[model samples]
Target: MAETKKTSATPTKVAKKEKMLRVTLVKSPIGYCKDQRQTAVALGLNKLNSSNELPDNSAVRGMIFKIKHLVRVEEI
Candidate 1:
């Protein structure tokens, strides 16, 4: 009898799932906290009526919460 060798196959890679949230600046941050202003800046919103799409993560959510009164959020 002859000896035989077995070969293993490579595993397939799966794509990661990403979530998105639409944020819009409705109000001004003139009298808001510094952190709130910073968050707005991070979101790329400097003036009113500006909108941005950000990853729906905990950190972004926290920032939105910090400036909830200064902006509006929608799931997209």
Candidate 2:
């Protein structure tokens, strides 16, 4: 006589990852509108050549877009 073994089936899933963006204040916002200046401060860039690593999300993208002329962005 022979013995048999049983096995179970399982499914595999892919892992998700979080992305980050580098935001830098390349130009001064001194002459820009109050709203633009506020946006820079909101992004934690109060001085020239300052930078912040922020999550790559809609909210952060929106802020960067607002100050595109006054700042630079990079992917990390």
Candidate 3:
């Protein structure tokens, strides 16, 4: 047998948050490996002193690691 129950309730708000990583190009990527230069561009850094706020995730972290010498990373 199947039975049905009635209930009235309000859903509470749930906030989901993800940490952010601040990446900035501090040095020139010229003379570096092409792949490393590309990684820096892919991270939204096209020029020295350029900065981008990216998600603090593995993918972004990997990109940063690839161009670590050309950029600086901070957690926000």
Against the unseen true structure, what C-alpha lDDT does each candidate score? 0.90, 0.93, 0.90
Candidate 2: lDDT of 11? 57
Off by over 4 Å in 1: 1-10
Candidate 3: clashing pairs of residues = none
Q: Cα RMSD for candidate 3?
A: 4.5
Clashing pairs in 2: none
TM-score of 1: 0.78
Show how many residue pairs clash in every candidate, following the order shown: 0, 0, 0
**Most TM-score-accurate candidate:** 3
- Total clashes, candidate 3? 0
For all predicted structures, in order, the TM-scores are 0.78, 0.78, 0.82
Deviation (Å) of 42 in candidate 1: 1.2
Among all candidates shown, the one with the greatest lDDT: 2
Task: After superposing candidate 3 on the true structure, give the runs of residues whose Cα lies further than 4 Å from its correct spot.
Answer: 1-13
lDDT of model 3 at position 7: 62
